[model samples]
Target chain A: MADFSYYIFCAMLLGGALVVLLSRGYVNAAMGMLCSMLGAAGLMVLMQCYFLAFVMVSVYAGSVLVLFVFVVMLIGDVKENSSIWRKIGIVGLWVVLGAFVGWVSPMLSQAAAGLSKTTEVVFLSQAKNYGLVLMTEFMLPFQIAGALLLAAMIGVMVVAKNPSRKKARRELV
Target chain B: MSYLINQTATCMPALLGTADCSYADMALFIVLKVVFALAAIIVIMCFAALSVVAERKVCAYIQGRYGPNRTAIPIIAAIPLVGNFLKKNGLMQLVADGLKFLLKEDPLPAHVSKLWYLAAPIMSLSPILICACLIPFGVWWDSGGAAHPLAAANIDVSLLAVLAIGALGVYGAIMAGWSSNSKFPYMGAIRASAQVISYELTMALAAMSVVLYMGSVSDSPLSLFEIASAQEQSWFFMTQPLAALLFIVALFAETNRLPFDMAESETDLVSGFHTEYGSFKFGLFFVGEYGHVALGSALFIILFLGAWNPLPYISYPESWGWISTLLGFITFLVKISAMIFFFIWVRWTLPRFRYDQVMALCWKCLMPLALANLVFYMAIAAI
Candidate 1:
């Protein structure tokens, strides 16, 4: 049953990614992304990392994808005219991605083989364990990531604010 | 196979009739689980349907008018006191409304995207049904006097699961609005996504405060069952009033109830995201809203109102066995009914806020308040 579920989730992940790559509509693409995220989360659950799985669903699929759909709707349905340069760029990107994957696959398979040799696989199942790891070993990296997010938020606020209005207010003063 | 069956039968004597079967125990377990889940869904859906009638009746009573007191079945209406009582309370209207939705012509508009229009209602209702599985409705005490939550799936991170599943409900509204291909619905969808996203933060933050407090008092703070069990001596509302208040307000917004129901504000937007929906499709959206309300109320009860516990400092005696479980379930139902009534009362009493005001209140007022509440609880937890 576990292996069967693993294969099913793998199919879902690949199928969803294919849909994201091939779908025309922005909404369809977003939904495809959601399906992919759910598949990944399912795999995470299968790995017994329940806390991370739920966090993935809540943070990425829930909030981020909703925002993506929101923006897509707000922008209205406009078909992107695939210019020649864009088509070329897409092909070039795919070639690079394929080459990178080709380079990494052997090493990944080797690592997996080595990992299978190890009897015990440590997995963080509890939120407290995750908290402890973040606060201790990963403290600096986590804090830096948080600060980066803060900076990005402030940047958005700054960019979103009307510069002309600010200038006008300054002139009035 | 015979040996397998014999081994299983010896361990599980309840399946004596299926003693010859190989996977009888596993099949029975799966079937029983599915049945329990279906029962939970049916109960929630029934509550949603009844709450519709309750909303109408409450609105009528408040406005000094009779609402749907005449809809009655043929033979059932001819019966004695029971029929009269049902007629007087407009209980039969539930049947009438349901049949009307089912039997009515399901119209498909030319302008709308058919696929998304079809999918939206299912998307809306399924999340609520899924979340219902995580709620610890009441406690069932075993012979050993240990308490077990009467839930479909009692997981460690059920609270997070609820929030994650609940957040996906936005897709239904967004899809409904976007697929309608109309101005009002598009606007409503925009409003819905924004409103849901904004209030979700406050809701999570508020719940986090409770979680923080629960961490100090309980073993597993993230589990709804643990949260409820921790509140056996004292309800969280007494201690975490501000978090409770914030959570309640966020709940109102998240469910798109008044005065925060800018998505479907009838005056401005005809029916908001569901403007193009008709017949059973519209009914699904209606039921989904009430289902959210029902689940949200149950969650609130679990979090702040002490779950199956009757009152503050008062708990069900484990020695009473199944009777205690029955009483606990009844108490839970009664509490949820009162919360639903409170939802209706507030809806009828308060006027809708302007969209800008709603956003402003969420960001400027509620967000900061929720953050402060979280900080306060964090400090308390630290001490």
Candidate 2:
């Protein structure tokens, strides 16, 4: 049953990616991205990472992809130019990407299984366990990441500050 | 893995065993889960429908008018004293409203995006209903001393599941706005998305504060039932009132209720994202809003108010757990209903905020307060 679900989610992920790449309209592409992200989240659930799965959905599908859809709407509609050569190129790209994924997937699954075995604790992916590991084992790196985000947020504020208002103040001075 | 499997399997009553479970068990479990889920949804739908009537009645009482009281069935009104009483009290208003919605022609404006316009209402309504499944409405212990939650889905991280799924409802509002291709709804959708995204941060932070407190108190994981049980002696609202306050405010915005209803402010955006929506589609959005209010209030009770927990300093004895569980369930329902009434009261009493003020309140006021509350609690817990 789990294997069947894996196939369905993989199809959703791959199909959604295909739609994102090949769809002509910006809104369509955004919707495709949403589908792909949801598929990825479902895959995370299958992998027994429930917290990460919901985080993927809440952060990506909920926030980031919503912003993406809104941005696409704000930009108005984009026209698709469909040509034979573009279709052929996309098909070729799919073949290469499929081959790469097929070659790498087994190795990735093996590594995931090995990690689970090494831990000797299946519920380590639970939120409390994750928090324990994060706060204790990776506290420094986590703080650094937080600091980096804070710096980036400050940069955004500086960049987006009203330049016209600044110029007006300078002129008055 | 077996522990995790059992936790999930409890949600499916048919598959209550381990690897030795038969196919029959699995099939029965799936059927039972579906039936339970359907029952829960129906109960929510009824609540949503009745809440409309309740809201109107409350709003009218607040403004000194009779709202929807005259919408009685003629035949029922023909009856003696009881009929007149029912008619005057607006008891049949829910039925009348449902009939009206069903009978109305669903108008699709020629200018709208056909696909998304049709899909928007479904999108808006579904996530809230799905999130309802994860909420623990009551707690009952089996004869074997195993505690069971009266909920649909019983996974850990129930809090995050609810938040994440609830967040997806924003797309429905956005889709309604953009797909409508109308100016008012477009503005409404933009406001809706921005408002939701901003408040969600504060809401998450506030919830995390509770989660952090729970973690410190019980060393239990971030499950709703666990959190509620830890508050048996003292509700989180008493200790962490600030977080509860922030969460309530954020919930108002999330449900698009008045005072923070920039998305569908009738005065400004002409019904907001639902400006172009009418008939049953509009009904879905309406019901979805109420469902959010219902579920949001339930979550608040669970997180802060001590779900199914009796009064402060009062403990339910384990010797006769069933009676205590029943009392707790009743208490939980009463708390949730009171919260819903408060939602209506606040909606009518307060004035709506300007879109800019809404954003500013979330980012400038609530966000900072939540962060400070979280840090303060963290320090206290550490000490």
Top model by lDDT, which number?
Answer: 1
How would you encode candidate 1's per-residue C-alpha lDDT over B32-112 as one tens digit per residue? 667768878887887898999999999999999998889889999989998999999999999999999999999999988
lDDT per residue as tens, model 1, A5-61: 788887777678766765668888888889889999989987777889999999998
Q: What's the C-alpha lDDT at position B281 in model 2?
A: 95
iRMS values for every prediction: 6.1, 3.2
For every model in order, the TM-score on chain A comes to 0.78, 0.85
Candidate 1: CAPRI quality band: acceptable
Clashes in model 1: which pairs? none
- List candidate 2 stretches off by more than 4 Å: A109-121, A136-148, B1-20, B74-85
Using TM-score, give the best candidate's number: 2
- The window of 10 residues in a row where model 1 chain B has the poorest summed lDDT is B11-20
Candidate 1 lands at a TM-score of 0.91
